[model samples]
Target chain A: MNQRSQAVRDLLEAVRAKGFDPGPDGPPPDRCWHEAQVEVGDPAQYPSVQESQES
Target chain B: MQVGELIARMEYEYGYRFQQGDVLLIGVNDQGMGGPQAVLPIEQATVEQQVQGIHEEVLPMVHRDYRNLIMVRYEEFDYHETNGFHDQFTASLDDHPGGFEVVAQYKVDQNRQLYQGYMDQQWASPGLRWTMPGKLPDVSAQMRELGYKEPASSEAEYLRSFQPHPEPGFQPLDQEQEVSHLNRLAPRVSVEVARHALATTASTESIEQQAKARQTLGHLVAYDEDARDAVAYDASISPAKKDALVETYRQAPAKQRPALAAAAGAAWMMSGGGLKAGRAIMAHAYQSTRPSDRALVTAAEVATTRAHMRPEEIQEAFGKEIGTDLEAAEAAHQEWERLYSSTTTQTETETVVETETVEEPDQMQLALEHQMNQPPAPVASSGPEVD
Candidate 1:
């Protein structure tokens, strides 16, 4: 699974484990979640967002 | 003489046996001012006679305020009985505006009277009452076994859970779960609102500030129907007045209105209100968000004052605040375990200090002893220090 999917799975697991309802019946996460989508990419393909310092 | 001797003496004097299941009458007269008397029946008597006897006995003891009388049967004098026993009958020779009504022993006034023939004691401190419907399994160990990441810390993990998608692929619970979660959070959220009104704000000592707090609470109730209904249940405001207040709140500007509503809810709670209103406010906040979202805004407000509290302290506070909400307790327990395990692992990874033949003193204790033994430092001189 992609990293985001894994994260979502873990969340669902935690909620169920805690005996809390996942939503429609439970509270939504604080962040805007409906906008999220699965992305296809390789971690090594993208350069680090942080700029390298001059030696 | 001991209490037993005194009791025996009274029993002998009154020609009555003072024992369990022996019904006694305690009555208050017409004026409702002084002590109505206690009439103990030495011989078997009718309920009517017992009540009449109380009035007759107390008439001499009290000033003129005796017209109607109420009788309560004390079935047993046991300590436990006094704690929960509450069944009484009232008899009046003339019409009394309010008749004797059965009030829960817990709800009785300090002087032992009901509030307007209305007596219901439904609320209890958190840990004392179980809030959830059934038993919830302990899944932390199982989850950990599955290699799921344990929380790093209690408060952090709790707050993080409220963050959007803290756990990837996390799905929201169904409608029933939502209602249950909101119900469980109701009391705590209400208390949080009160805490915010009294502590989160800059000041509440001034009359203007107090008035503003009250007004804010008013707005909160007005903004939501459930909250409004709760206030109506608790407060004696007329329907028309309640409608007017709600209308005004509706007309108010949207800018910073949420804060005002919260403040108003707190004010209501502070002013001898809150039982139902607080629950409504929390439920309203819970409903405003989408199913997949965390209850961050409201949860943060509830958890704000507890920012500096430790995990154990937070758990204890929650226990005291809401009693035993199974889900909340388990969540806290998991947080504690995660923090504990991580701490232990870190300790094991660090190097150990050297051991010597001579026993080493505790560094902290040694420091304290040395400090105690040392002479006081010299006061500084006005002139420059000597070389």
Candidate 2:
């Protein structure tokens, strides 16, 4: 294994030793694909900004 | 693949490097449960970046997918990479996983050294869950051991250390003994120490014991100027106690009332009584005492003369008996206002001048106005005559 993978393994060991079980799961969540499409809404549409300007 | 395996694969494939003090939180949900969803790796550049990323990214994702079980792993590579290193311990509801429950874990990294040293000293045994939910470990002893010192008697922990620890099979002190014990200690220590001791006794002792302790405290507050001032300013003391103390001052002899007047006024202010009421209390106390007592007069004046007091309020508080001190305070306040207004006007004038000077002139308009005003330039252009 590479140095990075070895480091990850060591960290996982410490985490388990500290009683944190990631539980039975495999692969990253499907939401990983949605990360690329994070929406950027218009600033004027924000309620707080509009309220502040009105005030 | 396992979660760790996938993280390694993601790091390798995407060339994502994890540095010291990096945190990674992964959310997972059951496939068909219509529950929480997950997100990809978020790489925050700094502490501020991470905070913003969590607020903007992690929080919304969690809100959208409320059913996800989040597994958070924070890694610090080498202790020496930074001057300080801290561990993060987070816990959430076994069912839902990311909400207000995660606040405690966020605080862990700020005091890493003290916490790590504390955990090492106290709970070094294997498989112990030291940072379990609803359990906050006491680290004041470890903080002291690590040479983290606060002001001498200001800290609650320091005050608590003065309390006598009950031994095994030892009986608690009786009311008389407790009062006697406090009386003996009250004369030797400063007013703050005495106050703290009395407070400690009042919390654990019987009602009669509390009354005796309060009576002794009243004596200290009446006789000792520092004690009265300390009690007045102490925010930790309850408003009810301050009210009682102010009553004690009110009942003091006319000769001693002036000295206690300022303290009483300050206490009144702290108890949410308006400044008007506080000034009235001071004025009443002053009226009871002889006006010849200059020290008492000064104390009353100092109490009454505050920056927030308007001229009208001062006039109403002191009435016809307004001393030179009040007049001087009023004059000083007026002087401050005058200076502030003058400074503001000067700044506004300078800004206007700078704005006018900074703009490029309309050369054509200026030339036309110059031609109209100069009476044909004295016909010098046509003649080109000698001087």
User: Of the true interface contacts, what fraction does each candidate have?
Assistant: 0.01, 0.01
Instruction: Give the per-residue lDDT digits (tens) of candidate 1, residues B122-221.
Output: 6562211111121222334643453334433322232232222212221122346433443444442433232222221223234433333334333333
TM-score of each model, paired residue for residue: 0.19, 0.24
Model 1, position A26: C-alpha lDDT score:
28
TM for candidate 1 is: 0.19
Residue lDDT tens for model 2, B1-387: 222222322222112233334443333333311211122223424434444444444444445433332232234222333222112222213233344222111112322211111123454552212232121234345434533332232112322322222331111233575345434433224354334323423342344434444444544544554454444443112444444445444444444455445455544433333223344445544453333222222322332221222222322232222111222322332332332233334543553354345332322333453455421111011100000
Q: What DockQ number belongs to candidate 2?
A: 0.01
A1-55 per-residue lDDT for model 1 (tens digits): 2211222233234434445444432222332111111011111211221111000
The interface RMSD values of the models, given in order, are 32.8, 30.3
Cand. 2 Cα-lDDT: 0.32
- Where does candidate 1 stray beyond 4 Å? A1-55, B1-200, B204-255, B258-275, B283-294, B297-387
Q: Per-prediction RMSD in angstroms?
A: 30.3, 30.6
Considering summed lDDT, which 10 consecutive residues are worst modelled in model 2 chain B? B378-387
Which lDDT value does model 1 have at B194?
A: 27
Interface RMSD of 1: 32.8
